[model samples]
Target: MNDATTSPADSALATRGAALDLLFNVLAKRVPFDDAWDASRPLRALEPRDRAFVRMLVATTLRRLGQIDAAIQGSLNKQGQQLKAVVQDILRLGAAQLLFLGTPAHAAVDTAVELAVARKQHPYKGLINAVLRRLDRERASILAEQDAGRLNTPDWLWLSWRKTYGTALTRAIVETHLGEAPLDITVKANAAAWAERLEATVLPTGSLRRAAGGQVTELSGFDEGGWWVQDAAAAIPARLFGDLAGRDAIDLCAAPGGKTAQLAAAGAQVIAVDRSEKRLVRLSENMARLGLGARVTTVAADATEWRPDAVVDAVLLDAPCSATGTIRRHPDVARLKSEEDVEKLGRIQSRLLYRAVDMLKPGGTLVYCTCSLQAEEGESQITNLLYRRPEMQVVPVTADEVGGLSELLTPDGYVRCTPGHLAEIGGMDGFFAARLRRVG
Candidate 1:
């Protein structure tokens, strides 16, 4: 993808080349898009605008992959014989442009054909050209034929949502995932002032919401480290602990620390622990950026086996799961994760839940949360926790605590914020959180 290219056309072509390669890895190898992009030399070499384009191209291809494939397959002449995965990927990139991104037919098609040649997929050049042209010419009809809400989402996710949330709510959730999530920030101080200064909406829970896209680091307060990007929904679990002034709190599984930052900012003496040393370093750096380094300590240890020297006042285990709740922000989740992944993550979540409660002082709070829509990862964890640990009892998240938003709470009073919640104000991540007390 990198070459001695100066002309605008050549640069754009090279950008598409990078995108094609990135898309191939994500689709063919099941590599996470962010990881693939981080590891891509050509993408890094491109100018910022080109880099953005490449990212958009691949993300859009993955996001609308089902629809994109439909357009390509419907255009194919042969019924049974299918294009190679790489060839289908090229057409997907082109179709994503023509069908969704508003990329001009000539530019999208020509560059995709070039990408075919670059990827040594030149044999299917005419096929790529033909499929893309037909998609462009019949974009409206092809679009009309698509059930994007149903088609784009994986069967496992769709069925799970339907079974859990029911067909109507599931529709709302999947349709919402089709779009990109907006930016939400938790300001270190003066949320109203930051909201006004940033021209962002102050969400009821105090996280500032802004339509502002592009580089978050370029934003005004970012350099000053006044705020950190955290979804309004993702901000909930951290707030459940209330004022942690002088209290010792542990953010079990904290990395790229958002909740850990919240705990520290709330005047808690926070220990942010994660198994990955490299991730802990990143979290420490981000903490420094926010000027909360003094209040926080970083620990690189497997939380399952690691325990605090003494039981602390609070423990927040945002146990990792399928992450199906944050699909709007990370579209790759729908493709990257499977049912088996959820089952495996459930086992880990259970282990982490037990470890988290063990690290909590008696009568102290332990908040267990996950960014997953799956029942096994959310509700079931709490049920099992109560059954296994006779010392523990559900504290039941109250509506008053979450900005008087009762809908954010489930019937059993655990916090269950889904994509359908706050739909009028651009929905939040699908997050489930429960606060428990060690009654023993």
Candidate 2:
């Protein structure tokens, strides 16, 4: 009955337990879900198939956490007796598998009890079994009765979205977050060729999107380094520059450098800088893989404090912000980020933008962007920057330049891609990018 029984199924159950542990790290300890995943010894021991399953278990649990909790509370009655934390996480893992991931009821319940017993919460095994069994049996009715979007989203994010995008769009945005995002990649050349080979669709924004999920590293062109994974929306900021051939550009705060690769692909002599040496190492590795290391120079320095030797022809400042726009891909953002975090990030963004402006040559192009939905970090940041520096003006992005993604363009010509914009195409991450020209 114990996990050490050496059965293949029990070995699989251990993967589910690992997922629950990751959930505790994110929800209770406030560690980034990805960081927890990266540090998982259990995951490394599993085959690639089971490793993917563990990732699915954690992501599905977080993405539907509110609904899972509501289901638990409903099963427990209105009395409000709280279960122990470990027991609750085990139950959530079971519920997610049953209700959302098409796991059979018996397997779901059995795994919940097994994980509970394994983790020394044997006292709650019977209770967990009862609740999960009830939930599985009534999964349809329970799910239908709930307002999943409202229940799943934290209140602060809900209010922020409503205030910034209004009620209708806010609902749409949250609805989109419930779905999994497709894999999008930017190719070194011959996008159409790569799309055909990869069985992907070429997006209007020039990135190829793969809806059928698989191991990205296994895909063609991955080992060859002919392409790199970049979200379709995230690819827009780098493309704002029409031509960077032989031009000098600085990618500030650029680690895990997709944008830097794009700039280098465009023939820009790129100086990619970030404060984290570890991140810079990854960036360098990625650049080497893409055959772009020769075009880029790496520097590990705090972009806020570091300055280029002279003004560059172009500067891409992907400022740090509460990455609220990426909820679909990083469902933990809804649980991990807070309103205070947004305000704090806004100040940091301001400082980075000011420094970016200072580093730009007169008439040099500066692209300021963030994977954030809050106006404080995106629209308002630009407004404040313009008000303070009269010399800089918004350089309107055109529909033609971004492969006809005109709907994502704001009235003032800044590129603002929301989750709702490309819903028909599996949706892209919400992002805001503004190209500015330094006239003074």
Candidate 3:
């Protein structure tokens, strides 16, 4: 092939190489991949298009990690040994492009070989070329008979899901996670009006749905502060507070505040409390863009350690949890989390909920919420809190409060959404929320 035609693919592979090197380095140092991506100074230095390409490769590879690893193994040396993790990442990226992304075989192999040579790993380039060429030859047979679950998830995680959710639900959940998440936005006012302005579709819950990709700031009405990005289900807990006009509301652990904005927009005087100043910086920026900054009181302090000046009319504690519920939108969640981590977060969540109740006014509303699908972090934690705080009575949410989320309510009126709940019309991120009122 001529130099011009060959250069683009070579450049794309180099970008992939840099991204994988960065990913493996961070992962080896025990950094969470999402945090690593956010903290990557090198990745940030690249052009926006190059950054997008690298992010796409990394994200897609991780989403189909199990399959990518399998493909690499199947294309390995006769010794049955795999390449080093760094080289393996390169091969996986190449495999992902060729098999899944439909990039031409010549481009994928040629560029991957070029990348290997550039890295001074020249000897391995022939191996990469041979295996990838073999993969191209056997693409149909390899893909057709492949078991999706075995090829898409780590064995332990797969086994855990099988035992926890049973066969059918686990399969469906895993399959749902494979697709790109839809972009759902919450508007300050009418969803229909904002949808028309943004040229997006309005969902049943009044969230504006747009197909994925694009710079969020470039979208129309973004500069005008017309709406904010929020999962449809995530918008429920704030709404369940129900007409907070002229009320005093405390949003605990409220950094990078979506629910806080929801409250502020509904006319509540909001105290947004969070421990991290860095996170609160983003929250403050969002508030400014949305024009809700004037309504919010930003407090950088731990929720458990810091006491409010006085009791508020309402409290919304969107406690930190395993965050497994957001996996579809953030597939890196799976790579970073473990079951033991979930237990630790559940303990912390329980503590925060108890502290939030102590800060609520007598007979005032307190909404406890988590973006977690695990029962231990959601229902179990809430159930334990109820037993300890008898004066706190469940103030069941009415159908009207949730808009179209009536079907997601528990028998006692708590809100729960899962991968299984809304799979057809663009599934929702899982969440658990309960409304309680202090009786004494």
Best by TM-score: 1
lDDT of 2 at 346: 93
Ranking by lDDT: 2, 1, 3
TM-score of each model, paired residue for residue = 0.97, 0.96, 0.93
Model 2 TM-score, 2 decimals: 0.96
RMSD of 3: 2.9
Taken over the whole model, the C-alpha lDDT of each candidate is 0.88, 0.90, 0.81
Q: Between candidates 2 and 3, which one is better according to TM-score?
A: 2
* Ranked candidates (TM-score, high to low): 1, 2, 3
Off by over 4 Å in 2: 1-5
Q: List the residue pairs that clash in candidate 3.
A: 67-151
lDDT of 1 by residue, 334-409 (tens): 8999999999999999999988888888889999999999999999999998899989988888888888899888
Cα-based lDDT at residue 422, candidate 3? 70
Residue pairs whose backbone atoms clash in candidate 2? none
Model 3: per-residue Cα lDDT over 325-425, one tens digit each: 78787777777778888889988888898899988899899999888777787778879989999989898877777665577788887888776567887
In terms of lDDT, which candidate is strongest? 2
| Candidate 2: residue 114 lDDT (0-100) | 83
